[model samples]
Target: MEHRVVLVTGGSSGIGKSIGIYLKSKGFKVYGTTRRLDSHPNFTDFELLELDVRNPESIGFAIARLMEREGRLDVLINNAGIGITGPIEETPHSEILKAFDTNFNGPIHMSKAVLPHMRRQEKGLIINITSIAGYMGLPYRGFYSASKGALELVTEALRMEVKGFGVNITNLAPGDFATNIASGRYHAPILSDSPYKEPYGNTLKMMNEHVDSGKDPMLVAQMVFKIINTKNPKVHYKVGEFMQKFSLFLKKILPDKVYEKLLMNHYKL
Candidate 1:
């Protein structure tokens, strides 16, 4: 059998790197993309291609390069994302658009680029690394949630649209994981005298603590490998701590007010 070819965006570090390396260890030909190939972190086994998910031409170029080398791309992981931390009202409109462009539009662009190639092969998988926040809005991370939420809906629709073509798409909504996501987060300017300062400060601190204690990125990589090997994979998967994963179930079953209150309590809003 030919070695399966896989492409992972934002593979320079953290979850993307782990996924790329893990898949390679499983005997797949893995290619990871970073915006700057010269500065990419060390990953001895897999190939690293320069790609900027926010740029359509870059995405196509990287994919074409991989196809030239491998002939056929078996899987594409839309794992590149950015986070903005701030109250919705305080965040600049431009910042919100930037976040959405990277988190939501980036995946859409990559999927669009890969779909035709996958269709020609009549077999392929696109795994989107969304966030658990995609299922529910987060306090300081409103736009982040919104972006992932939008992508989540797209995944559902794409799965239905591509099922006939032997193309599988799914969203992996992960909880906080130990990664470099925090380093790239955009902090909304919060004035000391602002009304939301205290709560926002507390919430931001708590969010970081939760992230600091998050599960290893390799755990998520393991899950992705499982999904790849499964003949029939689900459309949505939650990869995180038990309670965090269970919260989505609660959100569906609990009354609106009840769920809202629980969320407020969780964030100390």
Candidate 2:
């Protein structure tokens, strides 16, 4: 059997890197993309391509390179994303747009680039790495949530549109797996004299703690492997601590205000 080729965006480190390495271990040909190849001097887990998801030309060139080498691409993990947190009042519009570009728009463009290739092959899988937070609006991370939430909806639409071509699309919403996402996220500096300073500060600290104590990214990678092998996979999947996954269930059943209050209590706002 020929090795199934995989392309993972943002594969330089953390979750993307884990997915790439694990898939390679399973005998798949893995190509991971990083904006700068020189950034990680010791990264030799798999082939790293230079591509920024925000730039269409970059995305195209990288895929072209992969196609030239591998001849066929079988899986695309839209795992490249950035985290952003700030009070909506203080977060710069430019920064908000940047988050959308990488987190939301990046996946859409990557999928568009791959769909043509997949359609020709008549078999492919696209798993989007969304966040559980995308299911609800978190206080300081509203923009981040919105961007990811948008991806979830788009995945639903894109899945139906491409199923006839033997292409599968799904969203995997991970609650919080220990990774470097916190470091790369855009955090609005808490203003000392601002009205939201106190609450925002506390929430920010709590958010970091959650990431620090979060589960391993390998778990996410394992789930990715499972999704790849499953035939007729579902449209939405969640992987995380039980309570985090349960929170979504609660939101569906609880009254709107009740859920909102629960969130406020969770964040200690």
Candidate 3:
């Protein structure tokens, strides 16, 4: 893994930044992308490139610059994403679209953009940073779940499609982490007169609290390093507390209504 060039989208902060720093410390050439390069004047852990996953031009330019600089892109970590929470009915359609564009389409486009280069070299790995919530439909976070879940499934199919080309793609679904995701999350306002006010409001409060008390982002970085060093990586990887990861196991075994009831009870709905 030494001197291998890695690109992490949304690397200016949080999990992406942590991964970049950790990899750089291990002697890998790492580059991170933020939509705005000037916003983070102090982010010197690794080179940060300007890119907005939702824009095709920005994606191409960033990928081109990295390819030119390093002459190769060894790994692509699709870690850039946004968090959205609100009653699906109450959340603006625009917000839903934005969430999907960033969380789902952006990664697909990124994978597509990098495939040619990877195929040409016949060696590359793409790690999609998804969410545990993506495994199930969570209350007030349906769209967010859908977007990540979409990426998860896409990774499954893409891995097969590109396996012969010597390219590997995988999903790393993390549980809540103490990142700035809360501040950037688009929260549907709690309308006082709305029918779902109390539940949505309570859920929103719980969501933010979970993030505030979540584990460090460095754990994810460690996993990223491990996956890179492995000769054969899996299609999906989860990093989080036991219960958070266990919940996915439960979802697989629990009946439909039982799981729904459990979620409702957990959120106190």
Local distance difference test, each candidate:
0.91, 0.94, 0.94
Q: Which pairs clash in the backbone of model 2?
A: none
Per-residue alpha-carbon lDDT of model 2 for 19-127, expressed as tens digits?
A: 9999999999999999998887898899999999999999999999899898889999999999999999999999999999999999999998889999999999999
> What is the overall TM-score of model 3 with all chains considered together?
0.98
lDDT of 2: 0.94
Best candidate (score: TM-score): 2
RMSD of 3: 1.0
CA RMSD of each candidate after superposition: 1.1, 0.7, 1.0
How many Å off is the CA of 198 in candidate 1?
A: 0.4
TM-score per candidate, in order? 0.97, 0.99, 0.98
**Of the pair 2 and 3, which is ahead by TM-score?**
2
Clashes by residue pair, model 1? none
Q: List the pairs of residues colliding in candidate 3.
A: none
Give the winner by lDDT: 1 or 2.
2
Top-down TM-score ranking: 2, 3, 1
lDDT of 1 by residue, 144-194 (tens): 999999999989999999999999999998999999888888889776888
